[model samples]
Target: MEAVVSLDARGQILLPKEVREKAGLRPGDKLAVITHVHGEEVAYIMLIPARKLAESLRQFLGPLLRELLGPEESEGQGGAGPG
Candidate 1:
């Protein structure tokens, strides 16, 4: 889905109704703005739901965290519980 939006005087862009509906966005939903820089300018910008962003990060990091912390600690056993 592609949309061309304008930044209003307040630096705010209103999402097109179709785009919002396609993305399942609702009033007051939080979106994370991501930008790609090309030298000194922004090449492009993307918006993703904040909830999805955290889930993506957790899915990507969970394995690495588990490896670094070991299975016991990763699974919340707290490693220092019993002697």
Candidate 2:
């Protein structure tokens, strides 16, 4: 879905009702602003739900973290605990 939302003087854009409803955005929902840069300029920006973005990041980093920490650390113990 595409929408052409205008930015206010405060640099805030109001999401269209249809767009917001389609995306399941709620009044107090947190959105993560993502920018896509092409060359030296920003091509566009995307707003994703913070919860969804976190889940995606966790899924993406899980394997990398496991590799960095190794088998002993991946088993939920026996490594340097949180600081």
Q: When superposed on Cα atoms, how far off is each prediction in RMSD?
A: 4.9, 4.9
* Cα error, candidate 2, residue 43 (Å): 1.0
lDDT of 1: 0.84
| lDDT tens digits, residue span 18-78, model 1 | 9999999999999999999999999989899999998888778777877799877866833
1-83 per-residue lDDT for model 2 (tens digits): 48788899999999999988999999999999999999999998989999999888777876777789886676584333344
What residue runs in model 2 are displaced by over 4 Å at the alpha carbon? 75-83
Q: Model 2: which ten-residue window has the lowest total lDDT?
A: 74-83
The residue pairs that clash in candidate 1, if any, are none
Total clashes, candidate 2?
0
lDDT of each: 0.84, 0.83
Off by over 4 Å in 1: 77-83
Candidate 2: residue 26 Cα off by (Å): 0.5
TM-score of 1: 0.83
